[model samples]
Target: MRGAIAAMVLTFLAGSAAAQDLQARLNDYPTEARADYVFGCMAVNGQGRDVLRKCSCSIDVIASLLPYEKYVEAETVLSMQQVGGERMSIFRTAAPAKALVADLRRAQAEAEILCF
Candidate 1:
């Protein structure tokens, strides 16, 4: 019984994250979110001059945060940043927070509903 209840809670929470709207999440996204993203990018990409570039996060991250078109744009920006300088771009060119905030808010709302 306890196991089943815990499973349900986890499943419900995941569903709530999926239910969030992209735009709303972006709009409501906190500054710390962006900072964390930047720091994560730096940590993942590393700081240095190399012939090849490495990224901090995976495509799944963008796919999770943005729509297909936005994801494409994000990729383009990342590519450009990589060519120019790794630290100079990445998160700076990531999908807009307004969009993320929409998704977050929606997901949070859904989770709240499921939680009670």
Candidate 2:
């Protein structure tokens, strides 16, 4: 029926709009950052063309889960935690810093599950 066809068309349009919105959000993740993540992921997982696909998927999942600003903050805190010194203690011990890294870790874990 025409009514059913119209409903289907509307549903398709809505889905397309949602897909575009999600792509826009994903675009907020910079190309260089995404490439760096994929490269690191591939290095850890093993290098190969197949690894490239998996790593790319991993970054995509991460992009979907996090805004770029939060991702960057989390990465910086985590990196600072690796440096051994009293001055770096804040990054290692602060609750807010820990929470930010935790959020990033959770997003990574989710990405691993979904992509790897």
Using lDDT as the measure, which candidate wins? 2
Tell me the spans in candidate 1 whose CA falls farther than 4 Å from its real position: 1-22, 48-116
Candidate 1 least-lDDT 10 residues: 51-60
* lDDT against the true structure, each candidate: 0.48, 0.91
Cα lDDT of model 2 by residue, 65-113, tens digit: 8889999999999889899999999998899999999989998999889
Point out where model 2 deviates above 4 Å: 1-21
> How does residue 33 of candidate 1 score in lDDT?
51
lDDT against true structure, model 2: 0.91
Query: Cα deviation in Å at residue 21, candidate 2?
Result: 4.1
lDDT of 1 by residue, 1-116 (tens): 99999999999988787666554544453445544554664575566533012221332233345555553444455446556556666445556634444454454344334332
lDDT of 2 at 27: 82
